[model samples]
Target: MRTESVELTVLCLIHKNGRYLLQDRIKNDWKGYTLPGGHIEPGESIVDAVIKVVVKRKKIIYRGE
Candidate 1:
């Protein structure tokens, strides 16, 4: 059988100052405060996924790095 491509997503939520990041998708399938991450290449680890999402979404530098 031919292999089918798949996409994966993850959310790394960060709560600070008594608030959290939220996203409202157009699909309306889901709505809420969520640290969203997704569509990372295969062989990538969870930590990398989180960092990629946080940096892209928040535009904040990773101090720990």
Candidate 2:
């Protein structure tokens, strides 16, 4: 059997004031309230993905590591 290992998606825990960002994954194998995430581009660092995908998508200015 052919097999391959790769980094695909990233989940982020973003909290503001008193709320945790989440999503309703209403498709595929995901069904319910789940953390926000998306596909990680090839050669992209996890930190960059978090900032570019999750943070940018939400439009929330994140200023901490």
Candidate 3:
């Protein structure tokens, strides 16, 4: 017997000053705009995963000032 697995992800609403940001659908699965998100890695928290994915996609990093 074999076990199947599924990856978990979280979608985030990026916004600024009452404006909401979204991503343009480029995949064949869905059409139109979508929120930014990615798969949750092993031993990674929801918050951490969100930040990591967002940073990777946006190419922005925080220095924790």
**Candidate 2 backbone collisions, by pair:** none
Query: Ten-residue segment with the worst summed lDDT in candidate 2?
Result: 56-65
TM-score of 2: 0.69
| TM-score list, all predictions | 0.60, 0.69, 0.72
Return whichever of 1 and 3 wins on lDDT.
3
Model 3, backbone clash pairs (residues 3+ apart or across chains), number: 0
lDDT of 3 by residue, 10-58 (tens): 8987766898878888788987888888889989999999888777776
For every candidate in turn, the CA RMSD to the true structure comes to 3.4, 2.6, 3.1
lDDT at 34, model 3:
85
Question: Which regions in candidate 1 have their CA more than 4 angstroms from the true location?
Answer: 1-6, 26-34
Candidate No. with top TM-score: 3
Tell me the deviation in Å of residue 31 in model 3. 2.7
Considering lDDT, where higher is better, how would the candidates rank from best to worst? 2, 3, 1
Candidate 2 structure quality by residue, lDDT tens digits, 1-65: 99998778988887879989888788888789988888789998988988887768868777675
Worst 10 residues of 1 by lDDT: 26-35
